[model samples]
Target: MAAVTETLPGAPTTGTGEGERRGRDRFHRGALRWVLLVVSAIVALLMIAPFVIMLLNTFKSPDDYSAHGPLSWPHEFYTHGLKVFWDRVDFPVKLWNSIWTSGLVAIFGVALSLLSAFAIGIGRVRGRLWIVGVFLLANMLPQEVLIYPLFRMMQDIGLNNSGWSIVLIFTVIQAAFGTYLLSSVLGTFPRALLEAASLDGANRWQILWRVVFPVVRPTLSVLLIFFFIWTWNEFFIPLVMLTTNDTQTVPIALASLQGDRMLDVPTLNAGTLVSLIPTLIFFLFFQRTLTRGITAGAVK
Candidate 1:
């Protein structure tokens, strides 16, 4: 046999060029990731800066706020500003009124809408289209149009200038849109489930309580938070409905505090800060529900 020419038949060589190309690609990708991270961090900080400014300024004196930059640390932390704002704004009463009015509005609004949506959105309902169209039309009406009629009705019912008046208006305004929203959510639910419940001798009320209510809890939580925030911040309705300090909500009270002449900047800022507390607390409680609801609603 001819002596086999010892040729290394295959020394598998990693091509230097290909290896260099992959290394370059990985380097670029890593650099891009770092760039993105830095950009996101910067954006987050920018968004948080305004809140930091507000919180710090709440504790600052008028002179300190004016003398130093908004980002500056206060030389003295004082509750004087907060105390002044509380005394001037009658925060306790206003806050209590806001909480009461908002809670009633949310409760009535959600309950009414949930009932309406179920009645109309379920397959058993006849004339669903007409009812939905009517709701849509009502939703489209300008809130200003209802003002006169509502005002007259309130006067007739002895609800004028009372917390109940505000609560009633909020409920009315919220019901139409709330119905639309919940109907959309209900549309996403499987119809087979309803049929199954009906076949199992579950009454409409039982289906609503056991099957529908659980699935809609997240949506309800989101709506409650939104209604609370909107009612808390509502100025126009409260302005028209209520004329007395005793019944006024926080926004009205805050606006009244910042009258044309007596400009107490520190006190105004402090009250503004205080006004945000309830909303912040509300968000803290419902944020997870809100996020999940939005995600689930969108997908369904």
Candidate 2:
């Protein structure tokens, strides 16, 4: 009629088709996001369920627990179990011993690992791979296999049943793995920064502390946290070494309550909860540092 235009065959058309495709894509993406959220929530619930159950049972009386089960809530709020466990274990002393030993081990172990990794990685020592392999092998060795010899050695050194002995032993053990890990990270370190520092008349030690250390500090902080947690949770070694009540850590103190025949479930749970509080607090305080360090490492 009024000069109508005819489109050629296979000509592109823009309208509802593209809009519908985009809408479908957005809908699929939203559905997928909801699915992932549901999965993550389910996983989180599973992870937290045991802790919730433990908390519920911790305040339960032995009679109440026997009547109802571990999963059931307490009929009445009870403080007796917590007080009994706290006094029986000398909670303050055990907490102090753990803090002291774990703190020292973390500091000493991080220092040792930093020095060893620097020598092997930045120094580029001959046969560095073999040195790293030895560390790996040492780390792989079972604590049980070394426990007897370690015990004998500690006895000979007159450090048996001392918190210092546990500190020293765990420091060395933790450093071995730390060295192996830090070495790899340091090996791939940028040469440009090191060269720049060298050109600025920086010696090896100065360069290490001033330039390299700052960049790698994040990784070291991560190592410090790991060392602290590892030494904190050490049961077998501490159990064997710290035989005395005053010298023992939290785990040993809690474990001492377990008898050959009867077990006080509520008391044990209360102690367990108390023991976890310190570590949980430690982790919470350092949570930001841990996250920042990890993020820094990832960015680099």
Candidate 3:
């Protein structure tokens, strides 16, 4: 029996097999991470390259630009483009309008979306599913079809050609999609959390503020960033609704810089750069929230 014990079981001849499998798994994970990192870096550079070239072009004189490609570096940096931008454009007024309109749109849109999303997500009322479906349908519908009716409605309501009209239009248009996106996220939140909060005698408001808000914080950040960026870059809404210089958003004002026969590349690039700063600043400010929120939503 003692002599046969060594071969009695169908055990592996070597213990290295399990260790080898683990090593392979670790190698695969490491290789995948490095590949992703490299790909992300390359994509980021590609996205930013055009902007960098624009910046370099801004510093170059017209003579240099004409003689060389836009991608070529300037021999000497000059402030001529900056001067031209500041002198020609009414930067202060347009900048103010852009800031005010975009801020109002983002704030109000996010607020309305939160209420609507929470209703569909947590309430699960009799027609909750139907309501969500309606929102999704609206989201899928073309904006062009909605514009005419919206314009007539705004006219009847005495909101046409006003900043508030533009803000309201953008907020409402964005709310449908925002509500759907946020609700999808909120649905995955643990129901046990709400139940525990209720058992502790917390009302709906308390649950929202304490329990739900904490968990949904990341989703809110994403909504804020999305709405802000969309509203900031919005062009057509302002063009149609805000017909006057006083209420014109940045994009509309910038579009007016185009001439029938000639194009001013420096001024155009300068304005483009100016328009991007606020968005970059906004994203930087909330980057931590954005990253964490996206990760949280994705992980679950």
Candidate 4:
């Protein structure tokens, strides 16, 4: 009975071969993981290299930058570039204008988007798809194409050169994209939840606020952040609308420095870095919220 073992000609004789194959698979997997990790690290470094260079130049003196070029380290730590840019542009005023305009646009834009999406997606309105198509078309239209007409309209209403004009313009523009996105998202919403809310004696408004709003709040947060950041980076519209120095934003203020002559490179870099700080801080503060919102939407 003990001598009755049989083996096929090409088959493995024992569990050793099977175990070795598994070990080889694990080794290959580990090697692949390390390769991916190294590639990701390299990509990250490349992405941040420009920012690092900018930071270095921001603190360098004009003489230092001129002598050694952008890639070289600063000869000595210098603060004059920052002070020059801060004073030259009246940075605080520009910062405030940017904050005020972008903040208003984000809030109003999100509200407008929510209302439009609710009507199109949840209210079961006729021609809703066509309505969404229109919003999508609006989003695709270039800002340059609409700028002249918008400027004239603002001027006719005497809102030209006013911060409110910028606020109002961007709110509508941002809401167009938001509506397009939120409508699609709301289209896939659960009908059972809506029905249950209605059965619990909730009206349309109550159901929207209590059931739908809670579920879509994460998406709204994402839209809010996008709106804020987009409005902040807007250059062409703000440039056209805000003519005066007092009404100008950070971007305009920075642009105004580049007259016909060559300007101080380090000073310009300093201003650029300073302009990025507020938005960076805002993003970092809301990083967790943004991640959670994205994750929730993905799981749904």
Greater lDDT among 1 and 3 belongs to 1
TM-score of each: 0.84, 0.96, 0.83, 0.94
Q: How accurate is candidate 3 locally (lDDT)?
A: 0.82
**lDDT score, residue 263, model 3?**
80
lDDT of 3 by residue, 1-300 (tens): 456446447876776898999999999999999999999999999999998988888777777777886888887786677677665667777888888887888888888888888878987767878888998998888767777888898899999988888788889878888898878877777899889999999998898889888777777778878887888788876788888777887788679878999887766777777767877888899899889889987775
lDDT of each: 0.85, 0.93, 0.82, 0.92
Residue 29 lDDT (model 3): 100
Off by over 4 Å in 4: 1-13
Ranking by TM-score: 2, 4, 1, 3
Model 3 TM-score is 0.83
The TM-score that candidate 4 achieves is 0.94
Model 2 Cα lDDT, one tens digit per residue, 64-163: 9999989998999987999999999899999999999999999999999999999999999999999999999999999999999999999999999999
Local distance difference test, candidate 2: 0.93
Q: 261, model 4: CA deviation in Å? A: 2.6
Q: What's the lDDT for residue 22 in model 1?
A: 94
Cα error, candidate 1, residue 273 (Å): 1.1
Candidate 3 clashing pairs, residues 3+ apart or interchain: none
In angstroms, give how far residue 79 of model 1 lies from its true place: 2.7
